[model samples]
Target: MRKLGLGLAAAALCAAVPVMAQETAPAFDAEAATQAYMATLSGAARAKSDAYFEGGYWLILWGAVVSIVTNLIFLRLGWSARLSAWAGRRTQRPFLRSLLWAAPYILIISLMTLPWSWYQEYYREHQYGLSNQSFGAWFSEGTMGLAISIVVMSLLIGGLLALVRRYRENWWGIGAAATLVFVAILLMVAPVSIAPLFNKYSPMEAGPLREQILSMARANTVPADNVYVVDQSRQTTRISANVSGLGPTIRISLNDNLLNQGTPAEVRAVMGHELGHYVLNHSFSLLLGFGVIILLAYLSVAKLVPVLLRKWGGRWGVTEVTDPAAVPAAFIVLAVYFMLATPFTNSLTRMHEQEADVFGLAAARAPDGFAKVAMKLSTYRKIEPSTWEEIIFFDHPSGHTRVSTAMKWKAENIGAADIE
Candidate 1:
């Protein structure tokens, strides 16, 4: 009877072991976890990042002012008129004349804005320790970009000017449609043709990481057979990845910075976010949204340009909406429209990005990884911001928002096998 009692007690103790262990396990506190993740990015690093990001708010205003002033200078000085006249002397064809006018107009504007561009893009980037390129490399890339812009913008402007001449009153609607089509074509072609001009792209080497990314792509119905890595480290240390292009042109790519800086889980988290963009059809949705905005801009320009031309046409040497010289005036209105629309545009993009974050958290199942990467991004992005500042300026979620999201997800899924 003594031996039996002892055995029974031992069984009872064994049965209670798991229950006791479970009871003692601490519940995940999402808010605490979020604060802990944010704490990692303190001191001078955090201040620098905040300063850099905050400075961009002023840049947006200054950039628009510069652009508007530049266009005004061209018009007031009759530079645009002289250039258009020169192009007319060379060609009788309206489209050819427009193209000729565009080449010199773009070149002159670029030259005029070089100082501001250099300060904003080169000096400011270096000041913030965000750039990796030398002045020569940066200038070379800028020149290439200038040439591409001249060609593309010239073609687009020429087409629109032709429509303006033909359609007269209805040109705005048609021009808007044409611009959307041009944007779509650029989207399809840029990844293959234009991006390679700046960076070399290669297949991600065969390995567990590559296989894992491909596996995620497959799981998400992303039509990618392989992953490509871009040599973005040559330009900046920023980590990034994307599933770019439309339909048949779609490419899955990550910059070398991501590969170098990110752990496997971090890579997975980033890739999953990018894949979410594709799966959620963000590109198409954005196009549709922006198309509406573009239509409104064009409509406003249509009404405003003619009125301005009538009042200032003689002084500006621009007589008609169809005149190549009038392009600057039209774009001045466009610049202002877009500048004012910045908050709305940023919000639209931010909403999509947040949705992607949610999708990535589920797909990658790497909440901690996601949180860590958000901290890494704090090297450039402000990790926290006031609510209104985020709504107005940020196109991506603040790091604090991302980390908090990940913590919340982890809290809910604490008992999952893969979660720690």
Candidate 2:
């Protein structure tokens, strides 16, 4: 009887083990834990947090509306179709017709948006206590941005023209792939060169926080030469850091606000999250995924455009597609396509951010830190979103999701030691 009882007890123990392990896993609840901590703090912390989000949410909404409305108005005006028709019909050189049609929309629409875009950026930022940059600074930045946009858009339109002229129906995928590569190249280079134009960067000053951050990087096998801190305080009060560049070009960078104001744990937490982005190849994944989307979407447009042109071109007074006036129509169509596709893109992006959140918690050993950061970012990022809101608009994990994960992690690893 005793021997039989022992055997049964061993079997029971074995059966319970797996369930126990699952229950005790060190998952993150950084979000909840931090909010709980925030709940404990006084008035100033809460106010600062609230102030952080002032312009971000509304601005994004307004910007999207403006983008769509502006494009729609242009399209409805038959501007592009008219311009393109005039150019295509008048130009003796067929080769130059599309370029001529595209040129006007490129110049005018950009000019149209410049004043409002600049004001929205400058005023909204100042209103939120997020920026200290002077008008000259803002203007200079805007000018550079406009220059880059023109270059990139020209390249993009030129490539699209190539596909439309030759492959026609099959061009969308190729064009999308081209866009991905172009963007990737831009990302890989911009951080090292273009970003420096606006702000000064220097090695992180000697400090315990710097030492600890470096230690974490080493432990993670991140080959960073030295950490850089930028004078982002010249522009904004918000704090951030990034691990930008690839291979030899890789730079581990943080803003002056991060160094000056953020707590050591907070800095570490955010850096860990950015490092998570690098370690996980989030950029690459996004680049490729976005490429696929562009390819597929453009293909759908390709399919739809020809039919629509055949159906409505005669009525709209446009003959061939290479019309300047049709540029507005095409852009509007593309905008609609992208707007409808937002849910899928947002979902994919959220997943990537969540993955980075996990990696950050592990790497920083500071789940609580990320949770607190969420409270801060809530000023700009949504703290919580309904499922539908998350699906349609957010391209990153909502603060609630981030904090909850952090809290869950804390709950599981309650005994884990805080960073030194």
Candidate 3:
């Protein structure tokens, strides 16, 4: 009688198992979910976004052409050679001479490019309702940027000129090494020294939000001690955040636009994505990857500069590749190479962004939030793109791609949200 009773109980338990499983299971339809997210944007908004993004594509090509033309004009008009001569006459000290030369050159470049700069950065932004900045405010920021450019260029151009004068034939090789070091230093300093020139950064207040961020950071081993908020709304209506810098200087900063405009879930999704950058060591990877790209660029310039000099050397008043006057010509070469490299560079960055998106979905468990934030990003980004367009231009996955990724994650997790 006891054995028979035990057997019946086991049978009853087995019968109930399928019912329990069915109750716990989540019902998620990835296709429907993704379609629903995409439906949130009106047809007009989508078209506007596409127009903005496509316009940027043309601007990039035009900008490159303008830069090359400007440099060539400076070379042909003997402006570069004249500057070199003026600097040489003024000071025997290399550093002083470079600074004096660089000041006028920097000013000239800024002046020459002002129309394009104003149109792209100020007028276009205002036209799109992306900027809240007044003309005075915009001009002030521009002046500051110009000053910063002068200072930075003075140092870099000064060093490169000195290296060119010293090394001549072997300068590119040595310069490549120096360039890598400079890159490292720049990365270390930019977050603290350079970024604050534009915006205020304050620690995020202690709260559930902070706690949540801390928990995520801890989970990912990101080594972030605090969350910082930057006043970005003063300039633009873009929401942004990053785990920037390297080594002990690494910082997690979100713009005020994010805090003001984002929902808690959206914030979490964004933070999770940013944290993935740290946890995955993307900064290091990008730095190293870009360093390699620069090395290749330098190598190509080494080979190309002399060939170009041989052709137009006397005409341009650049007798040799190492002539201080050759700076503009060298810049043109580098710019051309960089332009050609854009698609490859964007591909690499986009791949990493997609990885971070996956990481964010798993870490934040906020698929809807991710999709919504992606839609908001459609303010500036095209919601969809042709495969080749994305391959060549996008530095991140398209809005459609991002939303679909989240929905796919949701479909897999299904009822996991309810259970949690």
Alpha-carbon lDDT, every model: 0.89, 0.71, 0.83
lDDT of 2 at 320: 57
lDDT of 1 at 267: 92
**Candidate 2 wrongly placed segments (more than 4 Å):** 1-35, 38-65, 68-104, 115-119, 311-317, 323-325, 418-420
For model 1, what is the C-alpha lDDT against the true structure?
0.89
**C-alpha TM-scores of all predictions:** 0.93, 0.80, 0.90
Per-residue CA lDDT of model 3 for 1-420, tens digit only, reads: 443454555556778555545444345668888888888886788888888899999888888888888888888899988998898899888767777878888789788888988999999988888898999999999999899888887788778778877987667778877877887888889888988999898988778977887788888876556468889888988999987788878888988889888888899899989888877889888887787788788777777888878888789887765556777777788888888998989998999999999998888888888888999998789887899999999999999999999988887775564311
* TM-score of candidate 2 versus the correct structure, residues matched by position: 0.80
Question: In candidate 2, what are the lDDT values of residues 1-420, reduced to their tens digit?
Answer: 443454556557778555545344334345545567556434765455444444454555566566666765565567766766677677876446666666566776777777667768787677666788899988888878777776667666766776676775577777787777777788778777788887897887777888888888788777657468889888888877876765566677898887777778888998888778877877778777888788777777777766666776666655555444444546656766776777788888888888888888888877667877876676666565688877766777777777788777766666656732
User: Residue 407 in model 2: shift from native, Å?
Assistant: 2.5
State each candidate's clash count: 0, 26, 1
User: Best by lDDT, which number?
Assistant: 1
Cα TM-score of candidate 1: 0.93
Tens-digit lDDT string for candidate 1 (1-420): 443454556556778555545444446789999999888889999999999999999888888888899999999999999999999999999999999998888999899899999999899999998999899999999999999999999999899999999998688898898999999999999888999999998988889988888888899998555468999999997998877787677777899999998899999999889888988989899888888899889898889999989999999999989889999998899888988998999999999999999999988999998999999988888889999998999999999999999999998787678752
lDDT for model 2, on a 0 to 1 scale?
A: 0.71
